[model samples]
Target: MAVAAAVIRCRRLNIPRAFVISMMINAIQAAIGRSMDPLLTPPAGNSLHIKASSVDGVQIYTCSGGEWRFLSASASLVDSSNSSIFIGTYAYVYSPKHVSAIGTWSLNNSEGVIAESGHAASEVTGRVIAFRGNKFALPAFLAQASSHLFDGTASLVSYIQQIPSDGGVPPGSSSCRKGSRQVHIPFEADYWFWTQDRQPPSVPSELSAIGLMIEGFFGTGHVKYVFNGTSWQQKNITASMYDVPGGILVGRFFIESHADDAGGSFTWEVFNPNGWTVTAKSASPGVQVDGSSLPWRLFSVTSASFNESFLGPITQVQMISTRGGLPPTPMQAQAVVETWKIMLLQWSFKVCMKISDSECTIT
Candidate 1:
């Protein structure tokens, strides 16, 4: 009777028929559960629908018939941008699909505290790139595209030449032009740094911007002779690398370290961004090794890949035996191998990728 009286008064006034009808529908639906009775059929997977409510007195249950009773938690209506929606109390954030370049492209929290982007599992692990707590192809934030720090003329003089933006750093700078492989990735900088920062430790202050210190593969399993700064194989460095399962890495910067390896001083690890629940150390191990004596060699991830190297005292045994169990001769003139080596193998377990991002990935 009250509803009818209100409608009659509105009609006599200037209320439109459509508005009256919408208000009455809302009121009636509120009094009942929803417009449609809760149907017994479950909503199709990945699809949304509101079936008849499962109401027992005041308590509400979902339409899907599973548990003898999955009780409903309290929900509040949300109004934003001129629309109304409902959401649960807990929600997780994920990396964006389209923004591939190396920058924090999203922040779910309104306070701007969390930054999301691509990051290596860590300098030591180097197994998989990560993002937003998962594995992903997100690019490591080397520098802005215009920073020129990765443009082959970096003040630090990176051991790597400026390869094309097309993922040629690991194989060879020339691999891209020959189309030897498709190194398609979300990053624009394909680079390597033999030394932790690539520049001489005494470089000008302006060149202190920092670089990604990584493991660059060189000469057939590490033992190499250099002449005039050139390796015996006539090559120096081939690539810096990590393992990616199925050649697909998805993430935004949140990384994990692999378990410890007691056999060797270094450990290899990776993380997946696809919600993998593996326990991981969130930071890279602070380790570094020198590649000054390492030479170029072919390395492979799966079977079809090549050009890889790592940091180890490959010649340490040879150096020991050089004395022939007697007094050592004068060190071989340091010129041939010292000045002519192809690439330096400076290994560092922990490295700061950017000049300004100390422990920033965790932030």
Candidate 2:
């Protein structure tokens, strides 16, 4: 009721419906983040948390003899943009000794993520890339780096865990005993990827803003130049990365220059294409940039994404170096928007798609 009233008030105040919806979603997400169970915290130490995504798909099952046995699960891993990033399958392996399952994932493309559009199937026949994972439970497990079958993005992943699931339970025994058949039970769950690496692989930043604009054509890469004052000029930008996920590329800056512009005067908004809604905030008081007289503040990612293609899953991003984009002081006469240059450092876990069998161990 309160939310509905607030929405009505916002409409009366001439707020954009899209903006209002975005604000409400962010607020609700924040509350959900706060309510997460502390007991499910990722393993501590040097273990870096990387990608977290929601999985939407079906669990495959086959009726054998008088019972329905697990078969395989086929699903697509979606990002915040509602685009499928990874294609995954969980296949049950039957052994006279013990039953196990292997989970596999592949990049989504004509061949997918790492491949070009409309690429020929014959050209990449044996080169079909996928990451292998272990299954400890239904739609959940830990895949160690040492267990990866084919080397690639998955080779870099130290572990993966899925929790907080809904649906996908098999039908009752009465239904299974009726006849032999195959079934697909729909399910949704959250997945997380982890790695030992502290940062994602670096790609060259655009030397010129125009070049950055062109690069954005290839993928989600983009350069949004934010202005603080009229004097702010973006000279050389050395941090135009191309291979990072969508949210890491979004650099939305809001600045109002005046005498009142002091600490915590700026705000940045970033959205994850992998479905993780995140924001960046001022990390410190004004810090001196190399060429600019006025100091620009630093910001860090409050949240990140799930499994991405080349960079795996982004865990964190930091604005290590910056230039310009500072608000005017009281002594300065002109107060207008200006441009800023920044170099971003991104961290993520290496993720891949493949399947490997191992003893089921729930953790």
Candidate 3:
């Protein structure tokens, strides 16, 4: 037969190759057309080409039959039963329009919600609030004024200075300006002294009848007197005089040599108004009045020469000669005798005196 019987070459059937080819084709088809539930789905043939979404939550993709079904639950939107929701301690649940019903609420000790004015009538405002001790009012009048604000160190110093110190008088008080006036006694006279006297002189002699002023100032007493001579001298007297109140007179004197006569001398004595004696004797270069161990008194001798003179309250006088025991001289050493005297005078005066009208008997 002319049929192409001859071309029937017997080729060995490649079953293993065919099987491998069929398996590859099946895997490709599974990857392209297979669909599965996410929970029960198997791995895709190719690496999954999953497009990532920007949304944050639990997302699931399922391939069922031949189409992709995406399932997602957004944490922000989903109301999951087992979801962790943190409710602050201070959170209040009230209708949005009914803000007046909201009150201070605290959860645990941490979070709280408080009213704006801390009053029941005020609306609840603060979120994530805390109860710090007690609530206080918003200072309306500023506990103080802005003008009272201290801005600098100088202002603060002035404010502190204005504060009254302890034991101090406040401003505008009468005692604030009250002060004690201090009166000081003048001790200019070199013969100034004072004492307490208990007796008076027996007679008006050179050793007595001398009164000293006893003035009291600032709770203390003082006596003062003047010495005519410029130099201090020793006196021969060691007894005290009992005279005026608070007067104790001791003999004290200053001596000087005769200016006109060589080897001649003069002595001065100051006697207390009470019985007290003071005698100045002649010595080389000058007369020395031994006033050692003398009591306190005040006296003044205006003149050293023994003479009959009356000056201000001075009434009596005495004279004594010191030239008796001197050595012989070429000329007749006539003993020069001098007299000394003292006067008493009132030194204080008062200008006015007030008598009660009821006590006054006017004639």
After superposition, which runs of candidate 2 have C-alpha atoms over 4 Å from their true positions? 1-42, 46-56, 80-102, 107-140, 149-151, 198-363
TM-score of each: 0.15, 0.34, 0.12
* Selected candidate, larger lDDT, 2 vs 3: 2
**Best by lDDT, which number?**
2
**Model 2 worst lDDT run, 10 consecutive residues:** 209-218
Compose the digit string of candidate 1's lDDT tens values, residues 1-363: 001121211111123644565476446446633212222111111011111111111212222222212122211212122223221111112224523222111112222222222321111101111122112221232211111111111211111111123221222233334223333222232222211222112211222222222221111112222344322442221112211111122211111232333222121222332121111122222111112222111111111111122211111000000000111112643443444444333211111111122122210
lDDT (CA) per prediction: 0.20, 0.35, 0.21
Error of 1 at 79 (Å): 60
| Model 1: per-residue Cα lDDT at residue 327 | 13
State the local distance difference test value for candidate 3: 0.21
RMSD of 1: 30.7
lDDT of model 2 at position 290: 33
- Misplaced by over 4 Å in model 1 are 1-206, 210-234, 238-351, 355-363
Question: Candidate 3's residue-wise lDDT over 116-207, tens digit each?
Answer: 22322111122111111111211010000001111211111100000111111111222123242222111110000111111111211222
- When 1 and 2 are scored with lDDT, the better candidate is 2
lDDT of 2 by residue, 1-363 (tens): 000121211111123644565475447446647223332322221133334344657777788776677766655565424445543333333344433323444323344523633422111001101232233234444432223433234434444445536666777656876555788888775555444433211211211011100011001112233333434333322222222221123333333232122333222233354333223344445444333322333333343334233323322233322322333443442432222233221212111111111111112
